[model samples]
Target chain A: MTPDPAAASAPGVLVTGAAEEEVLAAVVVALRRLCAGGAELHLRAPPVLDASVADRAGYSTSFPHLLGAVSRGGAATDLVLTPAACYHVYPLFEGRVLAAPAEVSVLADCHRQEATTERGRLRSFRMFETVRLGGAEDCLAWRDDRLDRLGHWMEALGLPAERRPANDPFWGRPGRLLASAQRADRLKWELSADVADGVRQAVVSVNHHKEHFGAAFGIRTADGEPAHTACLGVGLERLLLALHHAHGPTQERWPTHVRDALGLTRSCTN
Target chain B: MTPDPAAASAPGVLVTGAAEEEVLAAVVVALRRLCAGGAELHLRAPPVLDASVADRAGYSTSFPHLLGAVSRGGAATDLVLTPAACYHVYPLFEGRVLAAPAEVSVLADCHRQEATTERGRLRSFRMFETVRLGGAEDCLAWRDDRLDRLGHWMEALGLPAERRPANDPFWGRPGRLLASAQRADRLKWELSADVADGVRQAVVSVNHHKEHFGAAFGIRTADGEPAHTACLGVGLERLLLALHHAHGPTQERWPTHVRDALGLTRSCTN
Candidate 1:
């Protein structure tokens, strides 16, 4: 997502802007550094996905009420607004077996029909995601490493957020059990920061799918066994909000290291 | 709209990425330079719009078949996916008289349910828009200046494009007449680029709305007269596509000025 340049220097309400660009650019640089040229970075994707694909991916079961349908010709088509970035990526590698760990970094526009109009909790938001697919041990290692990388990096930027137990927004009743299982297995962790509203917001998450996507999409390892997968997702807008709250409204007030990385010098947010 | 970084350097159908970032950044720089510290820059906006707002803005009538509705609890809410960046802006100043020429730049994700799977077109796309609201003369000058500025800058970057009389996508049969009127009156001008498909696609558009928005939204100019407005919208995806088609695949092959402007030095696309 391109940050709004006009609001770049100010703590104005516009989510991502030029002032936040340096931060986002630094994150991208970090992702690239982590990739070390070993992972493929992907930014190209459509906003909507095939309904059958989302259904098969368990979106309907997980977020049935949240699904945003794309109507075509006065009727709902087979297409659906993408609920999560990873949902689209897994289907792309359906029926494929990886000889080695394959990694990708992608930015996706995630859409959801929410009942709440809470600040920083938007129906449509951007997600910067890094995904790894391979054997279980390797995937777990990558996920854990990401937890460290993200936590440390946030602290370094002075937006010290904590990685805490997290849960997915699954559907009506059974979702309660699935969510419990998720937290029990420690499948998810959130990087949370206190915003101006005095509420801690989860701006980033690390998730280990443990062959969930692999089994559904038939993505296999070299041994022809279901692969394991892990994903790190950064809610870009929320992160920008947290940063604005932490670093005042102007980019000039940010640390020189942060500005140096983003290569941003002009300070008009005054 | 951010491009997948994997496909960023290479034009492999992903809309936004590292390459797009450089161009988008350059655009932001240009907007700031043009604003010259007087214009108020805005970056925060949600991806969706209220249905009633869209209705008052004439979207429900013009793009009746194209509205993307958000259904919750088995009923359609007042929310509709935004169709254009400017639609939401006009209502913000409804019934308010500007003290002077008010200028603003905004980036919005526009959603359109297109039937074509054509290249360079999608269901949802990003739009970077610069708008001016003032008296008729000032508004026209601002719009014309935008034409000159945009044309000169694109040429400076070596992405030479032509400006052609254009028309909006009005609704059904009667829309043909309305579109013809729009073109006849020179209400819109398009910046077109010749892509790999041997077809010219409009990457940007300059529009002059002489009190249409003001009258509809009750926006007023100084002295309490209906305000005249103009908008310059750059379709970031289409522009990026044009850049790829013009400069060829890899960033390394790009001109030195273009590369320098974007601060792009990496060349893994080889």
Candidate 2:
């Protein structure tokens, strides 16, 4: 359910899927359309597994430990391009926080059950009230937070998001905090309803857990919630795989839009 | 010219190089030495250039049509990896056949010229050869064309090379040919003495290129006409760079063997 480019005129869809084959298939279809529409394409590096986790996986048998540990044992475990940082958003819980209003009733019902009776227990969570945006901005500064700016950016682009208080699972609870904000940062923008519709369709076929094993989950958008609360994750390696599938394996045929998005066009020799 | 690894075995020097910074640096010092021996390291990647001539440049912004381009119009170009064919070992020239002796001589001289040329010129030349080694039994039947057993296995390993002579300027000549081969269709290997020393050093760098390039170049040892003839190379992205340099922009510490050979292990990782 990819959004129609004609309706939203959004930059091409950036998808992160479970397997290389699945993502590659989607990229091929997107590339065919983009080529026909004269859009540029770019491929970003794939999302890698956390380095610490890779070391624990014992991936050194097939390849040299120095090489195999870094190359495999992660999300974007291919042997082509170098690894780059891309933020994977996840809810960070500290204490207790509000649930989306729509989930209140359901959550209340679940909370009423005894811990031993329920399949899962309800837990209290806390999140940063605001997040930072751009360079060097602190998370407390709402003005600089992408979540706050997303509405305006979408509106400026003629794709206004419905504003409403909602829970941000990412940064809303205690999980893993990224070492550097840049590696955890992403550009958050509103998806047009038309585009959202397409995303919903595509999401049906995509396995939510496949993108980022324990970090990624889906949120239901209620009738009055933001048009859609999507975290535009930037998995560097996943992006590369997508691009490889969209365009040919060669970098020459990459779409211009994608190249520009990643700033790969900046001349750098191998 | 490449230093003889077998001769330097007691001192056991492995020289390697690549067209990448991290890879070159990483190859010199890995976290662990899979194979124990001292290695002399020479790290070199083609420098980034805006423009250059067809024969001497290593990189370019335009789609190079001649002299085996590495970058095509700002995109990295794919080098063809050929399988070890009988024709590669004995090249045909002007209705005459040049046996192993002539083939080896032609390749050696070409390598020397390419190595002595300006750095830019060396970059422009796409001189490489590859060979696939499987189980001892499979390697024995490599000469049989009917059963592409080795070639098929290499392709299965993700390297898809053809069992024919390459069509590069270095190998396309009537009397001259570049002896390039690969273990898998994707695992590209070359036989050259020009940057053989640099190549061998790169393997020891523990850099990313060791795996990314999977390139190993060497000259036959039976009749070493060229004094400094034997060398091996790996890729720039496949080596482990973290082990070679310290926590700065420069290399701070190289491995003990590399330190002794290059006399600079205390460099930064910059």
Candidate 3:
């Protein structure tokens, strides 16, 4: 990713004010427009999920370092903070056989405990994702299509983001081999952008999960085969910071097309 | 709170689907219109909050039973899932003097470890709140005004909810004293509605905090007096359940005005 000096001073995480809300609203609208294929949209989902569901999703085994467990009054509970928005989607389709491909779009506040407090690497952040479930070839093709569409969307917003092959930050010794295999198969591709001064980060990730979640959740296709899944996930806060970097901190001064794309027109009246 | 037989079988905690998304979006639009007064709107807030902030807010002492603590890999962390939406707003104004009263509205997913698994008393739920910070008199009057307006809104939606004096389920002996004091001061009023079969719940809470949060967060008015705070909070899923009870389960068969109010017209296209 190309370095941009303007994003060097971009505010990391926006937790207050109307501008942040406006930007998020705009992002939702844009995502809906981009994923307009009879998609089921969910505006909110619980931050915590059932531990059994997490275990079935292989979250702890794959990335144990990132899991956040929830307890009541210092006593352990059967819940963990959601690591990804798509995890919630998989449970909804569990034990069902899809007649055709299923499309789901959700915006959820996801949590992961990161070892580093670096910019754009927030422990708590919002994720806007469009998930597709179908055959393996269909899922991979959908992932590629989303990558191109998301890349164009970034360009439209005046941000220079590069799409590159990537892998999950898996845990333990076995995780190293898993990460290498994932890269060899090119299961993940990230749209990297300069969110801060010389700080390049992945703002969007498109991943293809080949029969992993479906096999775990007992979801199947009409052909008696485990369904494949793919997700195009956008990190909302990181995207906002990238916008701030490319368009400057002030919304009023940003290009008209960019503002229109993000629906950032300042309303005089509430 | 009047009983409604239709709501007896209403589903609780809708985590997925297009209808759930539509209802939430409608609730947000209605809230924005109701809270139209140059309010700062936040669509999201982290489910977990800093332990120190929760302590300063007196949440642990007041409602210890409802708090959910966060841990990473069995090790405790200094974080707790937010119990209410208003707690996040107070810390934003810490040690600051407001020139005028500040109005903020937020929609956040709140977690409260309720002892019961009854309908409408969810462990995890969405809260849409409009908060006000100003002088004591202003806060009290705002609370009353909100109570009246929200009552009308409920009536317009064809729901038979009663506005009654209430108190938080404070914990222990000291909490008992605080609850009694709050009740004596008439600081809290709830719009109680029958969300299910014989399940009377507080669908909305209008609270007047006379310098409590202000003192805790060190927020002051221009005249140097600690600011008073008030919040009008609506439980989204409970309200939806109440609506279902009042109008039946089928959205297509509901009254046109009610459908219009909720923006629940089933779109033919995505």
Leading candidate by TM-score: 3
Residue-level lDDT of model 3, residues B1-270, one tens digit each, is: 111212211122346455656677777778778764557444456677777778888998788898988898788877788788777777777788988888888777888878777778887788988889999888888889889988988888888788888999999998889889999989999998888889889998999988999999898999999999999999988998898888887667879887776656534221
lDDT of 1 by residue, A1-270 (tens): 121332311121233444465566555666566532455545545556667878787887788888887664346765676787776667657788887888877666777777664567667777778888899999999989888988877786678887798889888789999999999999999999866667778988999999998999899999999999999988877776787788777877888765554445433320
Please give, for residues B1-270, the per-residue lDDT of candidate 2 as tens digits.
Answer: 111211211011111222122333233332112111221111111111111221111111111222221121123322210111111211111122112312110011011112232212321111111222122222223323212433342233223333432222233332232223332232222211122223321211010112111111122222322111111222222222222222222343433453333223344221
Q: Order the candidates by TM-score, highest first — what do you get? A: 3, 1, 2
Number of clashes found in candidate 1: 16
- The lowest-lDDT stretch of 10 consecutive residues in candidate 2 chain A is A103-112
Question: All candidates' lDDT scores?
Answer: 0.71, 0.22, 0.79
TM-score: model 3 vs. ground truth? 0.90
Task: List, residue by residue over B78-178, the lDDT tens digit for candidate 1.
Answer: 56767887766766676777878877776777777766646676567777787788899998888788888778767866788898889988889988898
Cα error, candidate 2, residue B20 (Å): 14
Model 2 interface RMSD, one decimal: 22.9
Model 1 chain B: weakest 10-residue lDDT segment is B1-10
The stretch of ten residues in a row with the least summed lDDT in candidate 3 chain B is: B1-10
Write one digit per residue (lDDT tens) for candidate 3, span A64-180.
Answer: 899988888778787788789877778778787988888888777888888776778888788988889899988998899989988998998999799899999999999999999
For model 2, the DockQ equals 0.03
Q: For residue B80, what is the lDDT in candidate 1?
A: 70
* Error at A26, model 3, angstroms: 2.4
